[model samples]
Target: MKLIFALITGLVFGTGIAISGMMDPAKVLNFFDLAGTWDPSLAFVMGGALVITFFGYRLAWKRDAPLFGGCFQVPTGTDIDMKLVGGSALFGIGWGIAGFCPGAAIPALGTGRWEVALFLVAVVAGFYVRRLLSPAGSAKAAR
Candidate 1:
């Protein structure tokens, strides 16, 4: 049942990405290019998503548990530490250079692009590298 919901959710998300032209690296790059010919379409998509998420979280939290889950797995972290700052900076650098964030890269896979595949491989490698470097119990606790 959880798997079914996951699949459905992924499908909806991928469809939204595709429909929003987010699957195209050019479109995403254009959004980041403030000095050049900038595109604002992605901003509209992000704004719509933000509005939906704001209202959705409000309604979801009202429930004792999620529809298909035991409880909401919300992040407890609130402090802006070195780890958070470093990770954010690294993510921003990668996104700006490649014009493909993790979410965007995943849906771009459907396009059968080799670049997306390489990006995903690098992403997976980064995850493993992080796990290897993280303190034994800290990794589990972080998750």
Candidate 2:
């Protein structure tokens, strides 16, 4: 049931990404081009997602547990540390250079683009690199 729900949710999210032109690297790059031909479409897409998430969180918290989960699994970490800052910087740099974040890239793969495939390969490699460099305890915690 949980897997089913997750698949359905992912499909909906991917569809939204596709419809919003997020799968297009040029469109995404245009959104980031502040001093040039900046496209505001991504902002609208983000606003819509934010609105949905705001209401969804409110409703989800009202339930004792998720519909198919034992309990709500929310992030407990709230502190800002060097690792967090570094990872965020890396993510932003990668997105700016490639014009595709992880979520957007995953759906873009369906287009059968070689660039997307390379980006995903790099993403997976980054994950392994992070795991290898993390502290022993932190690596175990991730698992």
Candidate 3:
């Protein structure tokens, strides 16, 4: 049941990404080009998402638990530190360069594009590298 829900959720998310033109690297790249060929569509999409998420969280908080899970897995971390800042900067750099964050990239993999595949491979490699570099306990916490 949980797996079925997950698959359905992923399909819905991918469909939304595709329909919103988020799967197109060129479109995504244009969104970052503030000085030239700037596209504001991504901002609209993000705004829509933020609205939905704000309401969704409000409703979810009223419930005792999720429908398919015993409890929510919300992150408890609230401190701002070097590790957080560095990771966020790295993510932004990757997104600016590749024009594909993990969410959109996963669906883009179906397009049979080598660039998309390569990006995903590098993301996996990054995960492994980070784990290798972290202390044993920190690595587990990273997850």
Using TM-score as the measure, which candidate wins? 3
Candidate 2 clashing pairs, residues 3+ apart or interchain:
none
Candidate numbers, best TM-score first, in rank order: 3, 2, 1
Q: Residue 137 in candidate 3 has what lDDT?
A: 40
**lDDT (10s digit) by residue, model 2, range 24-45:** 8899999999999899899999
Worst 10 residues of 1 by lDDT: 134-143
- What candidate 3 gets wrong by more than 4 Å, as runs, is 137-143
What TM-score would candidate 1 get against the native? 0.89
How accurate locally, in lDDT, is each candidate?
A: 0.86, 0.87, 0.87
What lDDT does model 1 reach? 0.86
Model 2 TM-score on a 0 to 1 scale: 0.90
Once model 1 is optimally superposed onto the true structure by TM-score, how far is the C-alpha of residue 39 displaced, in angstroms?
A: 0.7
What order do candidates take by lDDT, descending? 3, 2, 1
Of 1 and 2, the candidate ahead on lDDT is 2
How much is the lDDT of residue 40 in candidate 2? 83
Report residue 130 deviation for candidate 1 (angstroms).
2.4
Q: Quickly count the clashes in candidate 1.
A: 0
